[model samples]
Target: MTRTNASLIGFSAVALWSLLALFTVASAPVPPLQLSALTFAIGGVLGLVWLWVRGDLKALRAVPLKAYVFGTLGLFGYHFLYFTALRLAPPAEAGLICYMWPLLIVVFSGLLPGETLRKGHILGAMLAFLGAGLIVAGGLSGVSGAITGYAIAFVAALTWAGYSLGSRRMKAVPTAAVAVYCLATAILSGVAHLATEITVWPGSSLGWLAILGLGLGPVGLAFYTWDIGVKGGDIQLLGTASYAAPLLSTLVLVVAGLASASLSLALAAALITGGAVLAARAGRQA
Candidate 1:
């Protein structure tokens, strides 16, 4: 794919995940654990099936156990914990909290070989973190749950950072192979989610449909594209495309009659986006 295409695909994945939130909230009565699990299971099964059809299931044998473990922690652990947080907290809160991954990635990237602290990266990190805080703090009109959910989401963001950092080490790995394993990790999380649920299948057709979207789009395709994007970090357009996710998510909300052109949210977005952009630039220049 061309750089533009790859960037588009990358950001689309982010939007797909964002769009799923509306479906999730519409069906919010379902347990987060179960929903998370179902999404992963479907995504993993599809990935594994594709791997098998392509005769690449054997590739799993060649993967280093350590790297696979890290992938699981990033892909699976992060998803499960984040979903759990959603159940404990509001989606809006969790969403903003989780974007901290970008900032965290900058911090983690600092530890990489030849990765000297850049002023842009430092500044960007501070900006993003501060903006994330404002978005969360400013929009706390009807927050639910204790600080624990927030805490879990925070840890989930760090785990995503860990995943991002570890993903940098897995360069040259086949994109499909990496995606399959990550989906496999997600399936494990889903099984754990189902463990406590009262039923095995989705309660309604809508629920099942959401599961399908969760698997095919967000859990499966999105991650695959993200993995591809991470591998092609040399592409500047990928950064530009990354902005599309929030915008896409916002679009999803608008389409669903969920979010609107609110001065407050716009302001919050400005703070978070501006802050994150500035901090990222500063960190890079550092």
Candidate 2:
């Protein structure tokens, strides 16, 4: 596929991820590690089915052990932290903080070979960080309660950004390898859950459906598409486009009545979006 096509496929992941917070919240009372295990298992099965249909199941065998380890850690670490953050903190505020991955992606991409870190990039990052500060400041009244979640969300953002950039470096790794990564993540999560978390299945059909939606969309196909995109597409463009996810996600939460709309969220969205645009422009000029 052309770079444009690859980038478009990558952007589709962003659209799917917009529903992440909503589905995660809806799948409530299911502890983070347990939820990760269930959703990732479903996602892994989806990937395996696709590979079988495409006759690409054999491609996984040639993948390096390091790639498997890296991918597993990346997927498992990010989702575990994200789910825990949302469980502990308000979904909207926590989601916004986690959305820092987009800005982090743009900034971190500068460290890649052949990429230049322009002044505009730095300025944009500062602006985006200020937006995140707004999110944290808005929750200051309850900081004593939510501080750990916010910190974890910040680290989750860092984890995902690192994963995306690391994927770019491993361009030769087949996208199908992510299937193995998903399964491995599921196993790791399951072990952790069994050791620490009590089993809490979905209490209702709606809750179960929410888990299915997450498995099929954000956690499942999103990773596959993202792997293809970062390896072959315009990484900087994808990073800039990713800022839209927070806005779309927050809107979804509001529409579903899972989160109330707030002025701080609106302002944070604007700053994040505008900062990404500015950073993208700088990248183009370079």
Candidate 3:
């Protein structure tokens, strides 16, 4: 695919992912681990079905064990931490914390071979983190909850950044990597579900719809598109552009009554978006 097309795909994936918090919030009464298992299980099945329909099931043979291991750790680790964080804290606060992945990506990508860390990259990341810190501080005030959850969200950011960086090295096996990721996450989350929480299905239509939406949009197709984008497109631009997703997500939450907007959110949005733009421009110049 053309680079432009690939970037659009990445944007699409981010947009789909923006809805994740809303669906996760709607799927309440289901434990985080169990929710991860169910949605990923459904998504995995759908992915396999897609491969079969496309006559690409043979591609799975090319996937290395390492891909399965790292990809699963990345995909599962992220959502598991993310869902758990949401349950432990307010969704808005937790979401902002988790969105730290984009800045982390810019930071971690610099560590990769052939990638140079620049002043603008550092400057932009600092600005973004400053904004993110404001968000966390603002949201945490007067809120009493498990600090462990917030810490988990931070780890989720790292996991996602690592996953994205690792993915760059596996460009030759994109489809296989994503397939293994889905399957492994499904299996791991299934085990976590059995060990941690009793299985309880979503009892309402809206709940079922949320699961369906998640499986199809974020967990299924979005992963596929992202694998393509990250492997084939300009990773810098895509990573920077990703800052928009959380802002969009927060807006959706506010509209849906799941979260309230605050001055911190607006300020964070400006800082993050502006910083990301600066970074992307700097990358282009370099």
> Number of clashes in every candidate structure?
33, 0, 0
Would you list the C-alpha lDDT of every candidate in the order shown?
Answer: 0.64, 0.85, 0.79
Query: Per-residue lDDT for 25 in model 1?
Result: 60
Give one digit per residue, the lDDT tens place, for model 1 in 169-281: 68756666655565667568667766756555556887777777776887777777777765555222233234445655665777888876566556656655665455435
Tell me model 2's lDDT, rounded to 2 decimals.
0.85
How well does model 3 score by local distance difference test? 0.79
TM-scores across all candidates?
0.78, 0.87, 0.87
lDDT of 1 at 216: 80
**Most accurate candidate by lDDT:** 2
Error of 2 at 33 (Å): 1.0
True-structure Cα RMSD, model 3: 2.7
The alpha-carbon deviation from the true structure for residue 2 of candidate 2, after best TM-score superposition, in angstroms, is: 3.0
Q: Of 1 and 3, which scores higher on lDDT?
A: 3
TM-score of 1: 0.78
Candidate 2 lDDT over 64-84, as tens digits, reads 999999999999999888878
